[model samples]
Target: MRIALGVEYDGSEYCGWQSQPSGGSVQDALEAALSKIACSDVRVTTAGRTDTGVHASYQVLHFDTQAQRPMNAWVRGVNALLPDSIAALWALQTTDDFHARYCASERCYLYLLLNHPVRPGLYHGKIGWFHQALDVERMRVAAQMLLGEHDFSAFRAAECQAKSPVRNLTRLEITRQGDIIAFELRANGFLHHMVRNIVGCLIYVGKGKYPPEWMRKLLEGRKRSDAAPTFSAAGLYLAGITYDPKWKLPHFVEPPLAALLPRMSRPGQSGCNMKIR
Candidate 1:
């Protein structure tokens, strides 16, 4: 049977999502725990691979297992052997044709930036930080320029192996409350470090280093060198994966991004749970 699962992980300690021979990747740890549960070696495929220090609130993956164990074994049982940083949120049996990566209709990412005169204390690895005050409106304006289909070569990482830089970015929303700024992006697909690189360019515009119109120029340039440096991976989160309802994915949690908004200030911060879809 093919089983699909929703995962939550703190990627701070691992190298990335792909399985590595050294066994440090999130995939390696998950496969290890899963193999123990199945009593055989197991391999899995993910919707997307997050880089090191990048987190995921609802990462999706699918694996074929002949071991006829109950669903809880795949969820709670595997979690028991796994490290504290990784968790299995929900699991459901899926059709053999369903693919965690290819079946995905869209992927969403969330980035948190703490803008203040001093560095972040509690949110060190959880968020990106900048010392200078950023102009949120300017960043918002610059972010709008990134919406829709475009050859995002300017924002893509040099090592990105994706065959095409063209992506249909459906959403790029930026919101701010207090010193914390939230960026929510949804796309048909993403190039490596694409979101972080765009965030870096937005910050440049926010800090008055360039006008909002410069974003269009960068997009037109198609040269990675002309764009701003890639932002930190610490702030990045694989927030959600969207699949067709025909696949019947289980409900994740009470609300989206709940696992990630922990570092928010109280009296509470508004707009932290920005819509992903």
Candidate 2:
């Protein structure tokens, strides 16, 4: 049978999502617990591969297993065996044609930044920090240029193995509240470090280092060297994935941090917090 699972993880402790020869990967840990439960080797495939120090609120994966255990065994039982930083949130028996990666129609990511003079103490490694003041309106305006289909080679990493640099970015929304800024993006697909690179350029515009129109120029340049440096991975989150209606997957998976922030408020208001959707 084919089993699909919703995973949430703190990528801070692992070497990224994929398994490596050195063995400190989320996949390695999950497969170990799954192998123990199945009493045999079991391989799994994911919707997307995240980089080191990145986090995921909702990650989907599937494995072909003949163990025939209860659904709870794959969820609660596997979570019990996994470390505190990793978990299998839900499990379901899926159709033979369902694939975690190819079946995804779109992927969403959220990047959080603490734009304050003081560095974060309590939320370190959970958010990106910028000491200088930033103009959210400028950043928002700059981000809109990235919408629609484009050759995004300027934002892609050098080591990215994707066959093409073209991608259709559907959304790029920026909002701020009390020194906290959230960048939410949705796309048909993303190249390696694409989001981070875009964020870096946006930061430059936000800080008055560049005009909002520069974003379009960089996109047209199509050279990685023309863009700003990649932003920190700590603030990035694989927010969720959208699949065909036939799969019946949840629309919002709710990152752990989302629960801790306030639901509504204006920027600079006292005790204001925002959730990236």
Candidate 3:
């Protein structure tokens, strides 16, 4: 049977989501625990491969297993052997056609920025920090240029293996509450470091280093060098993934950061729980 799981992780201690020969990856830890549970070698696939230090609140993945244990076994059992940084949130038997990556329709991400003179102490490694004051209104205006279908080559990483640079960015919402700023984006797909690169450029605009229209120019330029440097991975989170309605996957719950901030009155400015298109 095919089993799908909702996984969450603090990606600080391990490598990225993908397994490597060096062996400190969320995938390696999960597969090791799962192999013990299934009594056989098991391979799994994920909806997205996050970079090192990138967190995920609701990462989705699937594996083919013949072991007929109860669903709780997959959840609690696998989690038991996994490290404290990784967890299996839910498990469900899925159709053979349901793939974790190929079947995904949309992906959502959140980037948190702690905009204060003092560096973050309590939330270190969990948020990006900027000492300069940022204008949220300018950042929001700059971010609007990224919405809809476009060639995002300017924001893609050099090592990106995706066949195409064109992606449909359905949403890009920016909001701020006191010293905390949040950026939420939903897209049909993302290039390597795309969100981080966009955030870097937005930060430039927010700090008055560039005009909001500079974002449009950078998008049109289609040159990676024209955009700002890639932002830190510490603040990025794989918020959720959307599959076809037929799959009926559980929705992602809002993380506590949302409740701590006042709600923005903008159209797409809902809390951290992103709306899937």
Question: Which structure among the candidates has the greatest TM-score?
Answer: 2
- Please provide the root mean square deviation of candidate 3 (C-alpha atoms, Å): 4.4
- Model 3 lDDT per residue over 1-277, tens place: 9999999898888789999998999999999999999999999999999999999888999999899899999999999999998989999999999999999999999898878777866667888888998999999999999899999999999999999999999999987755668899999999999999999999999999999999999889999998899999988889889888899888775443453223322233333342332
Clashing pairs in 3: none
User: Where is the poorest 10-residue window by lDDT in model 3?
Assistant: 259-268
Q: How does candidate 3 score on lDDT?
A: 0.87
The per-candidate count of clashes, in order, stands at 0, 0, 0
lDDT of each: 0.88, 0.88, 0.87
How well is each residue in 1-277 modelled by candidate 2, as lDDT tens digits? 9998899888888889999999999999999999888989999999999999999889999999989899999988999899998988899899989999999999999888888887777677778888898999999999999999999999999999999999999999987777778888999999999999999999999999999999999889999998899999988989888898898765664445666445322235555445334
Q: CA shift at 186, candidate 2, in angstroms?
A: 0.3
Kindly provide the TM-score of model 1 when superposed on the true structure, using C-alpha atoms.
0.94
Q: What is the lDDT of residue 145 in candidate 1?
A: 90
Span of 10 residues, lowest total lDDT, candidate 1: 268-277
lDDT of 2 at 30: 94
The estimated TM-scores of all candidates read 0.94, 0.95, 0.92
Off by over 4 Å in 1: 251-255, 258-260, 263-277
Ranking by lDDT: 1, 2, 3
Q: How far off is model 1, as Cα RMSD?
A: 2.4
